[model samples]
Target: MNKKSNAVLRLIGILLLTIAFCVLGYLNAKNIKLGLDLNGGVSITYQTVEENPTAEQMSDTVYKLQMKAQSYSTEAQVYQEGKNRINIDIPGATDANEILAELGEPGTLQFADEDGNVLLTGDDVKTATAGMTNQNNNREYVIELHFTEAGATKFAEATKNNVGKRIFIIYNNEVISSPNVKEAITGGQASISPIESYEQAQKIASTIRIGALPVSLTELRSNVIGATLGAEAISTSLQAAAIGIALVMLFMLCVYRIPGLAASLALFMYVGLEMVLMQAFEVTLTLPGIAGIILSIGMAVDANVIIFTRIKEEIGAGNSVEKAIKSGFEKALSAILDGNITTLIAAAVLYIRGSGTVKGFATTLAIGIIISLITALFVTRGLLTAFFALGATNPKLYGIKKETKVINFIGFRRIAYSISSLVIIVGFIFLAMNKKNTGDIFNYDLDFKGGSSTTITFDKDLSMMEIDSEVIPLFTAATGGNASTQAAKVAGTNEVIIKTRTMTTEERTKLYDSLQEKFSISEDKIVTENISGAVSTEMKKDAVWALLIAIFCMLIYIWIRFTDIKFASASVMALSHDVLITVTFYAVLRWAVGSNFIACILTIVGYSINATIVIFDRIRENLHNGSKKKGLEYVVNEAISSTVTRSINTSLTTFISVFVLYIFGVSSIRDFTLPLMVGIVAGAWSSVCIAGPLWFDFVILSKRKKEQLSKK
Candidate 1:
C-alpha cells in the first residue's frame, strides 16, 4: 500500500479500537462494584473469644466468615484485622440488625442421640452445601454433608447401634432436626432432606460452614452504612473528576498544541480501557481507589509530557518531525520504564501484602499504570504519528525547546540536605508531642480506634457543614475537645451518622439531650453503637511489613537495573523523606489518620520513588555516555538540570488534579486529597534536589576513599 493509504488504514484501526473500548467500558460500567465505604453496607468486626488464637485458627475463622459473608452477597469481603479479629464487609446491605440476626452466632454443630449424648461435632464435617434433589417428581431442597474418615467411622458405628432410634442434629444447643436411623450407613456422605425452601437450606449450609470455626467469636462492633452516603459521594466525585480531567485536557492541548491534542485523545482511551479492565477483573472501587485513579491519570500525562518535551528538543535540534517523533519516544523510553516500574513495584507489594481498601487502592494504581503505559507508548505514539502524517509538522505547534544552562545542584547539596533533615526532624518532634498529648502517635480516627457511632435523625435535613459547625462543637465541648468526629449525611434522608471516641454513659446521654434540644430530634429516632477499631494491632503490623517489603523490593530493582548501590540508596532515602514529611503534615496538623491514611502513605511512596527514578535514570544515562570524562558533580548537575522541568511539570499537573479534588470533594475526600497534594510536592522536591545530590556525594566520597586506600 502507498504511504498515504497505509496511514489512513492505521488511523482507521486506532479509531475502531478506541470506539470498541468505549462501548465495552460503558456496557460493563454497571458491573463494577462499589465498596462499603462508597455504598451503604454492614461492616462487622468480630474478636476471637479464645485467647491467643493460633494463625491456623485465625485463618480457619476468616475462611468460615468469608463463606458466611458470601452467602449474603457475592461482593462480601471477610478478612482478618488484628491478631484475633476478623472484619466482614457486606456492600449494599443497609440493615445492621437484619444482617446480625441472619448471621447468628458462630455456634458449634453436633450430632446427638435421643438422650442428647454427642456422637460427632462440626469438626467432623468436611463440607456442607445446599443442593436440589428430585423426590417424587417434585424439587426438594437439601443440605449435602460430607464427613472426614474418622467422623464417618464414628457415624457408621452410631447409626449401626441406634438403628430405628432417633438422632438429632443440634446447633447452638438447640435441636434443629431429628431423623430415625434407617440403616447402618458406612458412607461419609449424607443429606438432610425435607427442607422447606432453598433459602432455608442455604442458611443451614452457611451455619454448618460456620461450625468449622476453631474458636468462638464475640461481636466487637457493627456498623450500618447508609447507601445514600456512598451514592452522593460517587456523584460528587464523578463530577469533580470529570471537571478535573476536562481542565487537564484543555491545558495539554493549549500547551503542546497538536501533540497535546493527540495526548488528550489517548488519555480518553486510557480511561475507557481502565474502566473495562476494572469491571472485567471485578476490582472493587472504593473512595480511595478513585483517588488512586486520579493520581495515575496525572502519571499517564507525565509519560506523554516527557515524550513531548523530548520531541520538542529533537525538533529544535533541526530534525524532521517524523525523525524527531521516533527519536523522542526512543530517548524517553528509559525514564518512562524506570518511573513506571518503580511505581508498579510498590503497587504489586501493596496488593500482595496490604488488606481491605489498601488492596483496592493498589489494584487501581497497578491497573492505571499498566493501561497508561499501553496508551502512552502505543496509542499516543500512533495517534501523534498519524496527526503528523496528516500535516501537523509545524515545530512551533509541537513547541520549541529553549536552550538552558545546567545549574550547580551539587554546590547547594548541603543546604538541600539540611532543609530536608530539619523538616523531617520537626515532623518527628511533632509525632513525639502528639504521642505525649493524646497517648497515641497520631490522631487515629474511628477506623483505627474503637469508638461510639451515633445515628441521629433530625426533623430537617442538615448539610455536613451545618453538622460540623453546629453539632460537632457540642460533642467536642462535652468531651473537652478530646473527641474526634466524622459525620456523614445519609443521602435522601435527614439522618446523619456521627462517629466519635468511645463515649461514657453520661456523655452519651448528654450528647443525646443536646441533639434533642438543638435539632428537636425525637428520642426514638436516635441510635448509638460501640464500634471496634477496624485497624487492629495485627493489621497495623501487616501494613508496616508491607511497606518495608515494598521499599526493599524497589531497592533491589534499582540496584539491579542501575548496577549501583548508591542510586538505590539515594532513591530509598528520597522515598523515606517524602513519607516522613507527609506523616509530619498529618501529625502536626492532627489530621485524622484513618483507613485512607494507609492509602495516602503508600501513594506517596509510589509517587516519590517514581520521581526519584526519573532523575536517577537520567544520571545513569549521563554516567554511561560521559564515562570518566565528566566529573561526578558535572554529571549530577546536568542530569538534574535536564529533568528539572519534567519534575516540576509532572508535579504541577498532579497537584492541580488533587487540588481540584480537595476543593470540590466532601470533608472525607478533602482529608485524603490534602495530604496527597503535599506528598506530590515533596516527591518532586526530593527528586529534583535531594536524589541527584545524594548520589553525587556518594560517588565522590567513594572515589576519594579508593584513592586514599591506594596511597596506603
Candidate 2:
C-alpha cells in the first residue's frame, strides 16, 4: 500500500473503533446502574429492641441484611447506624410497602408451648428449606427445619413434656403456627406441613433461616424515597459535560493543532469507553460518581498535554516529526505512569475501604484512570502517527516550543509558604469560631448529623423536579439548613418526604405553617419524625483510615519509582497542604459537610498527589541529565520552568470542565463541584509552589545535618 493509503486505513480504523465505542456506550447507557440518590429506593431503618446490642450482633445483622437486600439488587447497601440501628437502602425499588411486606420482620423466632414458655429461638436453627410433601394423596408445601444438637435435645424434651398438646411457633411475639405434638421424636429435624403454596413455604423457610438476628429488631421508620435529584439534575449534568468537553477540545485544537485533534478524538473514545465499562461492570452511578468521571476527563487531558508538550520540545530541538512523536511519548512515560498509578492506588484503597457511595466513586475513578492511560499512551500515539503519515508533518502544524529563561520559583518560595501558612492559620481560627458559635466545627448536613424526616401528603401530584425546586427551599428556609426531598413510592397518593437537620419545635411549626399556607393542605396530613444520619461514625473512621493508607501507599510508590525518599516526603507534604487548604475553604464557606465531603477530600488527595508527582518526575529527570555543576536550586527551578506550561494548561482544562459542571448542574451537584474547583486550584498551586520548594527544603536540611555530623 502507498503511504497515503496506509494513513487512510489507520485513520479509518481509529474512526471505526471510536464509532463502535460510542455506539456501545449509547446502547448500554440505560443499563448502567444508578445508586439510591440517583434512583428512587426504599430507605428503611430497623432499631434493635434491646437497650444495648453487642457490636458482633450488629455486624452479623448488617451482613445478613446486606445479603438479603442484594437479592433485590446487587447495588443494595446495608449499614449500621449510631449504636443499634441498621439502615438498608435498596436502590431502584419503587414500592416501600412491598419491600417491607416481603423483607420479613427480623426478630426472634420462638418455638414455645401453648402456655407461651419459649422452647427455642431462631439461633437454634441450623438451616431451613422449603419443599413439597404428599399427605393423603394431596401435595402441599412444607418447611423443613434442621436444628443444632442442643436445639434437637431441647425440642425432644419439650415435645416429651407436651405430648398431644399444642405447641406454638411464634415470630415477633405473634403466633404464626400451632401444632399438636404427635410424638417425642429424638430426631434433629422437624417439618411444618400443609403450607398454602410454595412461595409461602419459601418465605417461611427464608424467614427462619435468616431470622436469627442476635438482637430483636423493630421498624423505626420505613420510607420509599425518590431520587435525591430530579431528572433535570441528570440533564443539566450531561449538558455541563458536553459543554466542558467541547471547550476542552477547542482549547486543545487552538493550542496543539494536529496533536490536539488527536487528543480530542482519544478523549471522545475515553468518554464512550468509560460509559461502556461502567455498565459492563455494573458500577452504580451517583452524582458524586458523575463528578469523578468528569474529573478523570481532565486528568486524561493532562496526560495528553504532557506528551504533546514533550513532543513540541523535541521538535524544537531539531528532531523530525516522527522522531518527536516517539520521543515525546517516551519522555512523558514516567510522569504519566507515576501520576496515574498513585491516583489508582488511592482509588483502589477507597473502593476496598469505603462503603456504598464512596465505592461507586472509586470504581468509576479507577476505570477512568485506566482508560485514560490507554487512550493517551496508545490511541493518541496511533492517531498522531496516522495523521503524520497522511502528510501533515510540518513542524509548525504541531507548534514549535520557544526558548525562554527559567523563572526562579524557588526565590518566591518564602512568600508562597507565608501565604499558605496564613491561609491555613486563618482556617484554624474559623474552625474554632465555628465550633464556638455553632457547637460544630463544620456545617454538618443531614447525612452527617441525624435529622428529621417529614412525610407530607399533598393535594396534588408534584413531580420530583417540583419537589426539588419548589418544596426543598421551603424546608431549607424554615430549618436554616440544607434539605433534600424525595417522592413517596405509593401509586396514587401525592406524598413527598423532606429530610433536613433536626428541627426545633418552633422551626417545625414554622415549616408546617409555610407548607400549609403554600399548598393549603390540612395540618394533619403532614407527619415528621427524627431520623439518624446516613453517614455513621464508623463510616467516618473508615474514610479516614482509607485515606491514610492510600497516602502511605502512594508515598511508597513515589519513593520507589524516583529512588528517593525526599520525593515521597515532598509529595505527601504537598498533599496535606492541598487537603488542609480545601478544608479551610469548607470551613470558611460553611459548605454542607455531607457524603460529598469524603468524595471531595479524597479527590483533592488524589489530584494533588498526581500533580506533585509530575513536577517531581521532571526534577528527577533534570537531576540526572542536567550539568552536575548547576546547584540544586537551579535544577529545581529549571525543571519547574520547563513543565510550568504543561501544569497551567492541564489545570485550566480541568478547571473548565468542573466550572461548567458548577454552572450547569443542580444545586446539589453545584455544592459538590464547588469544593472540587477549589481543590483543583489548590492542587495546581501546591504542585508549582509548595511541592518543589518543600523538596528543596528537605534536601537542604538533610545536607546540613550530615555536614554537622561529619564535623562532630
Candidate 3:
C-alpha cells in the first residue's frame, strides 16, 4: 500500500484557514442588516368603511393631516400601510395625546342653527357620505347627504311647495351626489343613497365609513426601528458568525491537523464567495440566512472529510504520495459534487417556490452550496496542489490511516433493494391516503389563492377569541360559504391567521360583500389579491428548470473531472431518483391533505442533491484506485461500503439541524422546512442504495459496445 499521502499536514492547513475566516466574518457582521421578518414593526389597520372613498379624497385628507401632525412634531413618517390604514411610524414617540393637537385641522364640521343664520362652525356640511345597511338583504351602501338635519328640514319645507327643486350632495367641497326631495320631511331621518350598482354602493359605503382622519395620529407603536437596535442586531449576528467560524476552524485544526488547515482555507474561500454572491443576489441577511451559513460551513468540511477518507484508504492499499493525492481527490470529487448539487437543487427549488423569509434562507443556502462546491473542488485542490508542489510530505496532515476495505457492498445489494422498494411503497401509501381523503390532491397557499388579509387596529384590545367570533363568519359567508360552513382545519393553528380554503373570484366577490356587511369595511379595505394562472405556471416551470440546470451543470462537472461518462451518469441518475422520490413525498402529502405541495417538492429537490454528491465521491475514489481494474462492480461496491457511515452521519447531522428548524421555527416557515427534513433522508438513501448500484448496468453496456467495436 502507498503510504506517501500527507493527511496530517492537509488537516492542519484546513484548521488554520478556518480560523482566518472566523475572524473576518465576525468583524464584518456589523454591516449586515436584519430583514423585516426578524424585527417586526407596527401593522396598523383602519376600520374599513362600507364605501370606498376616492383615493384622491383619502390622499388629500391624509396629506393635510400629515402636514399638520408634522408641524406639531417632526418625528413621524406616514405611509399608506394598506387599503384601509395610514401607517405613522414615529421613532421614539408612542404617546397618542402628544400628536392630538394636529388632529381636527381644517375642521369641516358645522354646529348649525335651525333658522339658517351664521352659526358656530367652520363650514356647513355641504356633503357627507354615510354608510347604511339594507333592512331586507342586509346589504350596505354609501349614502351622500347634501345637508345637515337643520338644512334638511329647511330644504324639505322649501321642496314641499316646489317639488322639482334639486338638492345637491357634496363631500369635501365637491358635489358628488344629488337627490331631489320627494316630499317635505319634519324629522332628521332623510337618507340619500348614491349607488349605480351594488358593487359601486359597497365601494362608496366603504369610503364613507373610513371617514375623515380627525387630527393626525399621535404616534402609537411609533419609532419601531431605532438606529441603535439595527446596529445591535448587525453587531450581534456578525459576532456570532465570527465566533462560530473560529470555533469550527479551531476544532478542525486540532482534530485533523495539516489537512484541517487545507480544509480551513477551502472553507474560507467558500465563505468569501458566499458573501459576494449573496450581496449580488440581493438576498436580505436575516437570522435564518445566518443559520444557513452555519450549516454550509459544516457541509464544506464534509467535502474535505470525504477526500481525506479516500486518501487514507489509498495509503492503506500502499499507494505513493503523488498517487494518493491524485486518486483521493479524483475519488472524492464525485461525492463532493453530488452532495453540493443536491443542496443546490433544494435551494433553487426553495428560492423559486418560497416567498418572503423562506426565500431569504433558500437564497443563502443556494449561494452557500455553489460557493462550497467551488471551494471543495477548486480551492481545496489548489491548496493541496500547492502543498504537494512544496515537497512537504507528511501522512498525518491528510489524516490517511492504513485500513483494509472489507465487506463487499455489492453482496448487500439485496438489502438496498429491499429499502428502496419499501420507501417507494410507503411513499405511495401516503399518496393514496392523501388522495382518499382530500379532493384536490394539493393545497394552495394564500399567495396563489388570492387571499384577503386585514389587520384592523381598534380603540379596544380584543383577543383572538373575540376576533374569530366576529371576523371569520363574516368573511367566510361573504366568500359565498354559508355562515355556518366548515373550513378545512389547519394544523396547530389558532385564530391568529384565519384563512379560508381556495375560493373562486365570484366567491371572493360574494365574500367581499358579506365582509362589508359584517365588518362595516370600506370597499378599498376588502383587498382580494387575484393570482394569475400564468404566473403560477411560470413559477412551476422556473422551479423545475432550476433543478434541471443544476443537475446538468453537475453532470458536466463530473464528466469533466473524472473523465468518465459513467460516473457522471450515475451521479445525476441518483440525484434525479432522489428528486423523484422527494416529489413523490410531496404528492403523497398533497393528496393526503390538500395545495402548497410545490413548496415541499422544491425543498426536497435541493435536499436530495447532497446525497447524490456523497455517493459520487465514493465512486470516483474507487475508480481512481482501480482505474485499470476488470471488476468495476467490486470497486463500486468498495466505494459505497467505505463512505456509507460518513454519508449517513452527515445526513443525520443535517437532519437534526433541519428538525430543529422544522419544530421551533416560525409557523409561517414550517411548510418550507418540513419537506427538507424528509428530503434529507430520502436523498441520503438514494445516493448510497440507489445511485451506487445502478452504475453497473451503464458500465456493462458500455463495455459490451466497446468490445463489439473492437471486433469490427
| Highest-scoring model, lDDT | 2
1-712, model 1: which lDDT tens digit per residue? 7666767787888888888898899888878877666765787878888879997787667756766776775446565665777778787667777898889868888999988789999888876878899988999999887889998998899899899998888889877767788888889988877799998899888888887678999888887655434456777888888887888898888878888888888888888898999987678677767777877787779899889988988888889888999999999998898888887888889776665556667778888889989998999899888877777778888987876578998899899999989988988999899888879988888778768767788888776557767988988876778777766666567878777888888888888788888877778998877665655554566678888998999899899999999999998988888998899899889898987898899888887787788778878888789643767778888888877887888887888788877887877788899999989989998998898998888888999999999999
Model 2: CA > 4 A from native: 45-87, 95-214, 218-224, 480-492
Best by TM-score: 2
Could you tell me every candidate's TM-score relative to the true structure? 0.78, 0.82, 0.53
lDDT of 2 by residue, 1-712 (tens): 8888888888999889998999999987988877676776788889888889987877667755654564455457666666787878888777778998888668778888977788888777766767898878999888787888998999889889998898887777777667778888688898877788887777677677667667778888787767767677788888999999999999999999999999999998999899989888878787777877887887789899999999999999999999999999999999999899889998999887665456666877789889989999989998999999988889999999987468989999999999999999999999999999999999888777767778789888888767766788888789675554333333345877776777889999999999999999999999887666666565677778888998899999888998889999999989999999999998999888888888888887877777788788888887888533599998889888888899899999999999999999877788899999999999899999999989999999999999999999
Misplaced by over 4 Å in model 3 are: 1-36, 39-277, 285-291, 314-366, 373-400, 448-452, 460-535, 552-569, 587-630, 701-712
| Residue runs of model 1 more than 4 Å from their true location after superposition | 43-87, 93-214, 218-225, 228-230, 455-497, 504-506, 518-527
Task: Quote the positional error of residue 646 for candidate 1 in Å.
Answer: 0.9
Worst 10 residues of 3 by lDDT: 483-492
> Residue 530 deviation, candidate 2, in Å?
0.7
lDDT of the structure predicted as candidate 1: 0.81
Candidate scoring better on TM-score of 1 and 3: 1
Better of 2 and 3 by TM-score: 2
